[model samples]
Target: MRKYRHLFRILYLILLLFVFVNLLLGFYGYAFTPLLWNPWLYLGAVTVFCHIWYRFYRNHAPNWQNLVSVLLSLFAMAILVFFIELFFSFDGHDLVTIHSEYYIKEKTIVFQRGSLLDAYDEYHELVNPFVMKKKIKKKVYID
Candidate 1:
């Protein structure tokens, strides 16, 4: 167990880095799939795992300085996750001209606008129209 401490630390750091990259990609709208799990849950699990691993496997005594440093790192990661989640929650809208007509010296125009809520509505319509419609309708009203 002692001999594998370095390997475990490296793997742990790699896992954290992977999560960070995923959050960054997700923020940029480039993620293949949205994160399904809660970041707080992940942080909690990591904290518990590290505590057990170091206390038992590494035969290390619990120290306040170490705990504070670990918590600070986790807090920083939590802030990053919070920003990404905030970005996903907000929606942006764009206006598009769908059609225009000129007749008898009069001009007529049509406009089409879209947003993240609209996209979600379309997707939910395809999946389960009845339930999604009610849920989305409530959301729309709230918004």
Candidate 2:
């Protein structure tokens, strides 16, 4: 257990670093848009990484402590992200609702819910609907 401890420790540290960077990116904005990180995404990635680590790593088996730590961290990240969204939005609700669709003919995206948020691109990239509409108009006019 002692010999294999360092391996797990390194992985744990790397996971922490990844989470920290992701949070910062989400808070400030990602790819020129204010995007919130989804905790489930991180959780899935961590679980997959750990499974791979356990499979090929010598005689070392899965450790409950490691699993617990990872889950706890993920939960913490989820809560932090939830709060961050609240902090940014004027209302006490989510900054953006996750559901939306785009109409090519109208060149508009309509958000089903939330006053400030409206449709995202096909890639699920969120942007100000006003900006998106303007871009669509420009594109149509130029063509």
Candidate 3:
């Protein structure tokens, strides 16, 4: 572990630098130009490269601490990518709501904000359309 520790440290630093550079480019509207646009793909490639370095050069299993660090860094990069995508999806809209969990669950990117609600409540009114449209009242039961 001590023999290749310095080399691994350098690789980790390079990974951090790469993510930072790409984040800057992404914010400047150059996300999907050359590389570093797709966070998952780039980060996955970097992880694989790190894994190969550990397997071949170190000739041993990777350290858990190093793996966890790399994964967390990659997660931060993914969040940056999500923010970039969300920024671009808006087109001078009055209201914008981002549902990231839904995007992760379903492989579909929802660009338009709740069209019905946004159209109806343009001034950001806290109106529940369902309650307004429906006449169903809550049953009160006491036991």
Candidate 4:
């Protein structure tokens, strides 16, 4: 119906606004810790603000009110996963912990780089990720 279409439009606008705000925050790192600042966190803050805006339109736009919140949460979760993978990769050395979706169903982080560490590949994730990540944990990140 005409009403449902309008609801979608309203939801779209809210989503776009949140994206723009998060983009700005992503560009400006927090002062507390230079490297510690993450874009997703900044976006999360803005998303919360947008939630308040959604509350204002709740009565008339109840159907689409919480849609933005759901989407934003999903988006933030994806970003978090990416950051986690990057962190683990650098610390994981040649053995990058990868989530293989093609072959395995369960979440498996594989550390693979070269044949040198191939021998230790089995032990790649056996040890703590921090310790498991060594320059030669198996070998260099690249061959």
Candidate 5:
């Protein structure tokens, strides 16, 4: 049983990696924006929990360091991640809501929707329906 302790430790290390990456994905997914980080979408809680576990292992051990590591690691990761977002990343919510670009041939490209009212709002804000409307003038009687 003792020889397998090494095997168990190795497995624990692998698990830690999985958790860390999963958390990064989770945080980034929820973020769903372009930056040096934050993948630009909503990531689930499972992602966060898994990442917590991974970083938990890196700084802690079989000893009683888990509690201390968990607290500080979470704080550090949160601050670092948030700071990166604040200083570097775009507002993902905005990106997800509305976007526009022009092609060389004079066509504009726009995407406005998660398939809901928010989509319509984005379209209006970005696409300019008034400009897109057809123009016509009613004839008036001449005196």
Candidate 6:
């Protein structure tokens, strides 16, 4: 068991690094957006990581160092979750309600539950709906 301590430490560090990277990508927008949006996935990963840490340390006598490490790990996880929630709060409704539609012109149209309509071109650039409506009208008249 003592020989495996190094392995456990490596695994713990890897998990922490992964969580940090996930948080950074979440802030960067749409990079692992689906993963960030899923609270259950984050919760499960945190739970497993903490459980492994606890199980590993349980075999040894309690020490201040172990306790402090556990506390710091938990604190980091809490901060990560808080920031993610804060990010969601900024556009919570848009995330839950907006749906995207793809058009033949290689445009992606996003519809919000309310009155607003947003369109994005193939390059992911926002296109004014009024301009698109006029273009569609012209195409109809020409045909």
For 28-78, candidate 4 gives per-residue lDDT tens digits of: 421111112234344445555455555555545555646776678767766
| lDDT string, candidate 1, 4-107, tens digits | 66766776686567557645644543321122224433554565556555655355566887778767866776676566444444442111111111011112
lDDT of 5 at 101: 21
Candidates 4 and 5, the one with greater lDDT? 4
Give the residue spans of candidate 1 off by over 4 A.
1-62, 91-123, 126-143
Query: lDDT score, residue 138, model 1?
Result: 16
lDDT tens readout by residue for model 6, 48-104 = 666678676767788899889878888887777666654543342322211222232
Clashes of each: 0, 0, 0, 2, 7, 0
Q: What TM-score do all the candidates reach, one by one?
A: 0.32, 0.29, 0.27, 0.29, 0.28, 0.32
Which residue ranges in model 6 land beyond 4 Å of their true spot? 1-46, 58-61, 92-143
Off by over 4 Å in 4: 1-62, 93-110, 113-143
Tell me the RMSD of model 1 versus the true structure: 14.8
The better-scoring model by lDDT among 4 and 6 is 6
On a 0 to 100 scale, what is the lDDT of residue 120 in model 2? 26
Candidate 3 wrong stretches, greater than 4 Å: 1-61, 92-143
Cα deviation at 25, candidate 1, in Å, is 18
Against the reference, the lDDT scores of all candidates come to 0.39, 0.42, 0.40, 0.40, 0.36, 0.44
The alpha-carbon deviation from the true structure for residue 40 of candidate 3, after best TM-score superposition, in angstroms, is 11
Q: Give the worst 10-residue stretch by lDDT in candidate 4.
A: 29-38
Q: Which candidate ranks first by TM-score, i.e. highest? A: 6
Residues 1-119, candidate 2: write the lDDT tens digits. 56456766776676567556644544654321222223434454555555555554544555887668657866776676556545433231222322212232243443222244442
- Rank by TM-score, highest first: 6, 1, 4, 2, 5, 3
TM-score of candidate 2 to 2 decimals? 0.29
Whichever of 1 and 6 has more TM-score, that candidate is 6
